[model samples]
Target chain A: MIAKQTNQKAWFMVLPVFLVVAFSAVIPLMTVVNYSVQDTFGNNVFTWVGMDWFKDLIHSERFHAAFLKQLMFSGIILLIEVPLGIMIALAMPKKGWGVPVCLISMALPLLIPWNVVGTIWQIFGRVDIGLLGHSLASLGFDYNYTQDPIAAWITLIIMDVWHWTSLVVLLCYAGLCSIPEAYYQAAKIDGASRWSVFRYIQLPKMQRVLLIAILLRFMDSFMIYTEPFVITGGGPGNSTTFMSIDLVKLAIGQFDLGPAAAMSLVYFLVILLLCWVFYTVMSNIGEESSNGGK
Target chain B: MNFNWMAWTAPTASFFGIIFCLLVIMTIWELKCPGGGPRIGILRFETTRGDRLFVSLLGSAFIHIFWLALFPGLSLYWALVFSCIYALAVFRWV
Candidate 1:
């Protein structure tokens, strides 16, 4: 059923969400803004600084590299996970016992904490002991993520793919399931090939969910840490450090509160900006889709 | 209370903030997804409200504590085994 059209009073249904998001997001955000504009000693005493931290952060090579690395990593993750997830989801059974088993198993990786996902892969890729590492080494390959830059990057990308592709799969599956059976019946009667049927029918139906999946994955991957931090510790030589990793190091490790806060606001803004763009684009598509149906 | 408005309060505040957000999410979810399971997925393996509360709390606790209590010499594989056992118990009994 279309969402209840009770004179927009239904927005009250969204009240719980707003309260939660505001608490989780707004307070910390206010603090981050406070820090970004000021310098402080060990005590609660604070001194006013201007845009100095933002200026310094903007010019920092380390921040630039981390930012570029995050952008690239997010791009790569989106490219790999979205299509692969769609393919796997397409292969899944629509009905019967297999459907549930497959969906739950795929989701298993996602339910694991992000830090643990990293640790699992860290162990899973150990050349001496990790399943992937040991298998590769036994098969006579020189594979060491700790020492090899390419291997480290590959391991991280693959680990991410394994962990998050299920989210895309579930979203796509929901979209697919929502397609009326009449569309398939119409296609069969019209003698449309299976490939044509999928391209014209299923893909269009899934666009909004896929857009959400892509956008969520992009933001999350761009800011990803905890896992990579546990696994690679942002090293061999800064190869795996994303923007979020750099932010944590600045804020907590070095205690450079001013610049860290600056970077974080920028970081959060970048995510918000991208999400807005994605939201608008998807809404347009939804509008067009509804228009088409009429 | 003399609230140390800057440092000591941030972590605790953030933690409680997460809980409050999650509670609101749970409530909205209960309204939206009434009659238990989400619109998609298996019902037999479905987590009830009690099980869901247990899983989220237990999982988060594991995230915080797993690094602390590992035996000094235990292998990563052993740790994984222990985690899998924990997941099983949460899944089956929680």
Candidate 2:
């Protein structure tokens, strides 16, 4: 299937995509970079500020707490969603009309708008009229998301799980479906148990898609803002104020553009670094598993 | 018969209810024409009907989220317009 000569003209096909990305992503990122190194006041007055904002942000207790909270939230969601999604995908019906039914149902939560998801939980957690809050109260539990920090955190976590586990499920299901039928048939001929089949065949095959799912979930959860914003509005205290929320509060709420811009660059870098680590580690594990199987 | 309709009228309920309806419609459509055959699209990968559905739904969700985030005070109808166009393109090409 190798072509005799390499054709360079195919690169032209990708030009439009590159242009769109540059305009939509690169330009605005440059603007943020510009703001991160400069101070501005009324009448568009600007002053060079160097790395002062970044230095301050590094030392700020508020930034540290928010960063830690963001880490905890992302860690918790990944822990819950990845395993839960795999279980759900494993339990799904493999044949007949049930496959589409299951996929559609699972995908439903993911299609809803994020702010709408936030707003939904906001109302759904009202102690007076919301279903979850009311049911919890009737069951003799003290549940007030607006007043209690623990309850607010729990609500946020639950809301995130409900909204996002479907994504992981869908990705895992796709991975499962891509596995060849001959693998299962070979396992059957070898009298392999279900667990062994999954481990030796399905799990290895799913590693790539699983990595993708983890990367996406990590990035999205780390940058989560609108959902929490609409739900607890950063909570009874700053309990749920993740880095993104804190940046928004600094930029818009307090009009500290320079610091906010610097914080955002740091946030973006953190996500990029974590994703690289995840990709490298997961790919190494994938190689090791494949080598061991061989 | 004194059930509180207000309880069922919440936006969350409506959003979920709409999703359920979409699922039902998709199920019925699948029943009418069972579709698992793979076709190559713009992505140049073999994909089936379910894959397209997942991509379109996921893409539209991001489009709506980005739309709302970028233009806070604007009506979501504009996002809906973009999402619809995106769905059409996905179905037609990918």
Candidate 3:
């Protein structure tokens, strides 16, 4: 009903996407689901264990701890990046050569791979070798991620902020750029302060992009793996071990397929549910905007 | 959401077992009407080979490999490097 009219040409447009998702997303998901259900020992002997793994995973403290850590991490990152990105976006020059420079510099961090981001920070936070750690230590701060749980958490959070704030900045910048000159021009004639203009015009305009930025960052951060793993190895203690790390430990570290699969499904569902809530909120704003336009 | 354990297990097992069924159904849909796919990054190139995708990945891999060799017991870095190369290639070729 949603797509009642046939657009045969659009199928061509959609074909490549379907193939890629099928190969990557769908297939892997199936494998994970498969692993979740059945019991296996060594080479391919999979006995039907049913929902045993799921039950164990759901009740486990490890899973709960990881889930809580994930929630906290997402909440903290979104709080930091969204507001910081908005401020940075607002401060950015709108016209002339400054635009390109700001845009390019903002985009540079985003181009770096997630693991490399971890590596960069790993090297970066070394007291003897790296800049930040050395500077902090010079100022008499005890900075050692290898032995300190607090330090590892801080390092991972900083690494994530460094890598992903660019995304929020770019999205907010796009939203800012989309505001017609007339709005600002009229606001100017009415003698609006910078705060008033930003509050009335820029902030509302950015609602959609901000929502997208939040949802994307939430889901990615919730499902984060490589960066923290590379940087701290979920280390010092299990303090920073998020859900994905727990799942990986179950599946690969302990070779416990059943529990891991179960946990992965639950993890997947949590992400999906959060995404739906975020989606509903975003769409409500979009609907309100369009209705106002009408 | 009632966990009979038995009922939950059956559907869960069959859910995985019927994998080829869904794949076939999706393949049919693909045959009839292909729609969204993963986005590919299109880099500008001066040459026809346009092996920039491979080149960029190998360059990244080289950096990690170099780091791994220099730092004893840091070979786990290569796993991330390989995953990156795989993701990029998937965006390119798959």
Tell me, by DockQ, which candidate is best.
1
Q: Write down the lDDT of every candidate, Cα atoms only.
A: 0.78, 0.83, 0.77
Q: Which ten residues in a row have the lowest lDDT in candidate 3 chain B?
A: B43-52
TM-score of each: 0.72, 0.73, 0.74
Q: Roughly what TM-score does model 1 have, to 2 decimal places?
A: 0.72
- Summarize candidate 2's per-residue lDDT along A202-259 as a digit string, tens digits: 8898898899999999999999999999999997899999999999999999998889
Displacement of residue B49 (Cα, Å) in model 1 is 40
RMSD of 2: 18.1
* lDDT for A31 (candidate 1): 72
- The candidates' DockQ values read 0.05, 0.01, 0.03
Which candidate gets the maximum lDDT versus the true structure? 2
Clashing residue pairs, backbone N/CA/C < 3 A, model 2: none
The residue-by-residue lDDT of candidate 2 on B1-94, one tens digit each, is 6423112223434655676687787788787887755687886555667766766666665575456456656776898899889988887887
Cα lDDT of model 3 by residue, A138-224, tens digit: 999998998888888889888889899999999999999999999999999999999999887898899989999999899889889
Superposed model 3: Cα runs more than 4 Å off: A1-9, B1-10, B13-94
Clashing pairs in 1: none
Q: How well is each residue in B16-63 modelled by candidate 3, as lDDT tens digits?
A: 566457457556765666543323334321211123333443344344
User: What is candidate 1's lDDT per residue for A109-212, written digit by digit as tens?
Assistant: 98999888888999999998899999999999998999997898999999999899999999999999999999999999999998998888998898888988
